[model samples]
Target: MNPRVIGTVRSHLVSRDQCPKYGDTSMPPVWIELAPDFEPAATDLQVGDAILVLTWMHKGDQAVLRCHPQGNRKLPMRGIFSTRSPDRPTPIGLHAVRILGREGLRLKVHPLEVIDGTPVIDIKPDNATLQGTAEFSSLVNPDTGQAILSAARDGWLRGLFAGFNGNVSMRQGERVVITATGSAKGHLGPRDLAVVDLATGTPLTSVRASSELAVHLEVYRNQPLARAIVHTHPPKLLALSLRGEGPLLDLPLFEGRVFADKLTRVPAHRPGTPELGQAVGVASRDFEAVFMDNHGLVCRGETMTQALGLSEELESLAGIAMRR
Candidate 1:
């Protein structure tokens, strides 16, 4: 049975050739105007909600059964079904997205790699990965993504991160933008940061973002006041966290109150899991900076500069603790 066209993409592209390959993370979010017939199906959906989008790759050459992956001529040809190539017997485009905004039947979603005039086969709520959706990576706008990279490099130079460890993020509307996983933090560039829907974790881009993304998302959801976050595995902080009430807390001074007042320690929870995210969220509700037992620390602020400064100041305190 053929799928009914429930929606159409409204875009500025004048031709299919103008579209990028599927899952192009760099593409910006666009609008999907659903038909009046499918409007009732959108019940319970709201802004920031994650959805599974099914689109008919109308521009694809369905007759071609085999092709190189991503249209790369250097790769060996494979069956169309074996790769994500949009050209296939039934070019159904599958995408995980979050609702950015909605007005009547028109809705906006990010990085949906299809071109204008494409037929949308269906749209379903992304329930399975919804809880983990924020972990999915999306693209940060070029200018902003690049600016965050400079801070990331500074984080490395200042020893907030070592090797490929640590993560950084800034929230923008319905999504959270973060550093990519496994990329060298010491020498990061603009393309290093990715975006994911804040509520659903739907990756807005094709890049693989850091797994610790949940930590960032949880903080954003719990504290709308927080716009930026910095996470680091400082050796001194980790060492002190292992011992309850370390010198960082016992120091009798005004600096101690500024640094340790309302500080929270998340009970040991495995990193990169929803449980750990919940733990951080709970701790963050009352504290600007938190120490994860036997793990690391998370610092948040209204801006990246504040978060970065807090991270740096805490390091100094942790160093003092280590010396005592």
Candidate 2:
């Protein structure tokens, strides 16, 4: 069987040596100029859509079957298929990228490390239909999944961060429904959420849980009354934090007086680490809201709505304090 090229990559990197071994969120945008005939195949794609881009790595060596990982000569060589090395018998390159925009048949995407003029093979939406190893538990009901999506989008609309920088979760007995790791919170879909067992921190769904799952689990374990958690980086709050303002109790609003009783500040700890999770968990025993130094905020409540409301209230108060 022969595969035909449908497009050519337009990138500043002219050689494979100039490309990153793996692309990250900060990489510059590159254009995929598809053939005019393929316009119909890409018409449905829109900005912010997650997609998989298939390309032919023309510079790869088909005869090389094994190589050291990441060019680390100190490490042992492994089969090319076992690693992400571009060189292989087929030399097919797969990249998970977000559609930055589209002008006619030229689609702009981010974090793609392919060289200039590479042959584009196919494009597919990175949606929930992709299967995984997770065996979902019975606790992830429809309502729970929808609630998590709603909260994630709400937090995203609230301008918490520029991208998928926060996480939201709701407890269901021994398991919790959480936003998937690296998922664009503002554009979350059914596949962007995960169900994980709280006791063992193991996923019960096809997707992996947020990296901050440890922090959520700790809060649930420490606060029996807490049923939901919302973690976000409010711009105003982060600004205040940079100005050495660690507490939000200075506001003159009525909600400030109420939240102050349940508000506390925790020293900054590296995110997604056990230390951060422990510090937030200890603070959760008394404070419904936690101000993490140099980080953001973590709010817990008896319901998802309450937790989200508390986060909104605190952010509003921060905005007020900033103006004052």
Candidate 3:
């Protein structure tokens, strides 16, 4: 069978380093330029979607490999594959990054950790294991029994909602309730928010219950580690969705850090319905944020702080893209 090569990636050289210390060293942000033929596949990638990034080890110094893999100045070395050392026989590195969004031939990805101008050899979808880990479990909020609420309420959430013009809410156990009083952009005061229990699919009594209450309920129900959920209508994100843009191009922005592991993008669905909730649940199975095409954005964090931060970052990114 022929090995399929789907996309070609190109990044410029920035610097050279050894072992785990490679990502730690300073280097310019390498812009990843994908081949034009890959645009269709590239645009189709969504938040939380994982891709295998292959890069030519241009800066690889063979002599460096003979030294300690850790380059600790004391410890002896092992084979390259044994220690994830960049100095390998093939002089190639494979990194897994989350797709943040795209601009023309450039893709913004998260967790790149590679130096700027690194030559990218190829790009492929990452289809690996589907299992939870203690890493995610550690983010859960023990006091509130919510995973991401604390992080969401912290500066992260505030940043996400900064200048946000939409309704916001919080979920208590099985009940979804309104927590914020805000008007939609260009709309009048006191917009109503509604929430519905996922188990019963019944509306709860709250003046500002979230319209997409089911979506939140689904996250809480599906992901044991999830605690807080956020929904908003950032103009650029909504505009891209309306334009039939499937997912924002991946960029290595700060928001990517908070949401690196669990970002997902859901196709647009009618707002305030069980279908919307189910769609969100599916998209968020392995992601933190899900882009709802033609509608808005939905994100679940182990803490509200994390969720909030991601929300704000998403909006800011959208704004940045719009300005560009």
lDDT of 3 by residue, 17-103 (tens): 422364532433334776667677665443334567887655665555455656675787666667666666566777866555556
Report lDDT (CA) for all predictions: 0.78, 0.82, 0.56
Model 1 Cα lDDT, one tens digit per residue, 58-98: 87778989998878899999988888887789889998777
Candidate 1's displacement at residue 278, Å, is 0.3
- Decide which is better by TM-score, 1 or 2: 1
Q: Rank the candidates by lDDT, best first.
A: 2, 1, 3
Query: TM-score of every model?
Result: 0.58, 0.57, 0.42
Best by lDDT: 2
Q: Which of the predicted structures, 1 or 2, would earn the higher lDDT when compared with the native? A: 2
* Candidate 3 least-lDDT 10 residues: 133-142
lDDT of 1 at 36: 91
Backbone clashes for every candidate come to: 5, 0, 44
Model 1: worst 10 consecutive residues (lDDT sum): 130-139
